[model samples]
Target: MCTYATVQTTLEGSAKGPEGSWFAVTDATVYFDHPVHALAEHTLNIDFADPAKGPGARVAVELTAAAARDLLSAIQEALDSAPAELTA
Candidate 1:
């Protein structure tokens, strides 16, 4: 089942693309849907991109529900452990 529910946000960061090059990622699009290549039937998909730099300047990820939850927890843990000044 494709939820088609998408969430978009502005981001300030960089990502390494498939071409082995790093690019500034200015936006993120997250959604739950069928993946393009992952083995999972459905996944939580996230695309980090710089639209001004064209389609190639993008990184995509697809994770199963459990994996996505784990990733969220890991992210929170990392942030939580960081020094307040560093995170701020």
Candidate 2:
């Protein structure tokens, strides 16, 4: 349910970024699908999943496409509704 190939960390980096994907497990069920850019097409399967470490793996971004859009909308709405003083 994720894109990319295999998202990993070196125990000394932030698990937060669009390119630097990070997951917690392998068989982790995600609500949305992750687009993996491989070959000449976008794959939606785990080509490199390390279940030994954890079922939750990061193919790419942590948040799915749907989640990112929802969050961005929420933040924009909040900002639009916030007072001018606070924003300034």
Candidate 3:
């Protein structure tokens, strides 16, 4: 079943999009739903985008639940291991 649960946030970062090019990512849209390309019936989808640059300036990721949880743990670990001054 599709959760249809979505969340959006403004972020300051860069993500590599099409053609091995990089773009400023200003927003993140995260959702759990059917994936457009992933073989999984449903996935945790994340779209990093720079809306001002148009639709092409975006990077999308779809991960299985287990993978998503692992990613979350990895992110927390990386952040936690960083110097407080740098992370802050």
TM-score winner between candidates 1 and 3: 1
- Residues 8-70 of candidate 3 have per-residue lDDT tens digits of 999998999988999989999999999999999999999999999998888999999999999
lDDT of 2 by residue, 1-88 (tens): 2442443333322233234666443332233344544332333332234455553444343454455578779989999899989987
Candidate 1: stretches off by over 4 Å: none
* Full-model lDDT for every candidate: 0.94, 0.46, 0.95
| Model 3, C-alpha of 17: deviation from truth (Å) | 0.7
Q: Order the numbered candidates by TM-score, best leading.
A: 1, 3, 2
Cα lDDT tens digits for candidate 1, 1-88: 8688999999999999967999889999999999999999999999999989988788999999999999999999999999999998
Backbone clash pairs for candidate 3 read none
| Selected candidate, larger lDDT, 1 vs 3 | 3
- List TM-score per model, in order: 0.95, 0.32, 0.94
Better of 2 and 3 by lDDT: 3
Candidate 1 Cα RMSD after full superposition onto the native fold (Å): 0.8
RMSD of each: 0.8, 11.2, 1.0
* lDDT comparing candidate 3 with the true structure: 0.95
Model 3: residues >4 Å from true position, as ranges? Answer: none
Error of 1 at 47 (Å): 0.3
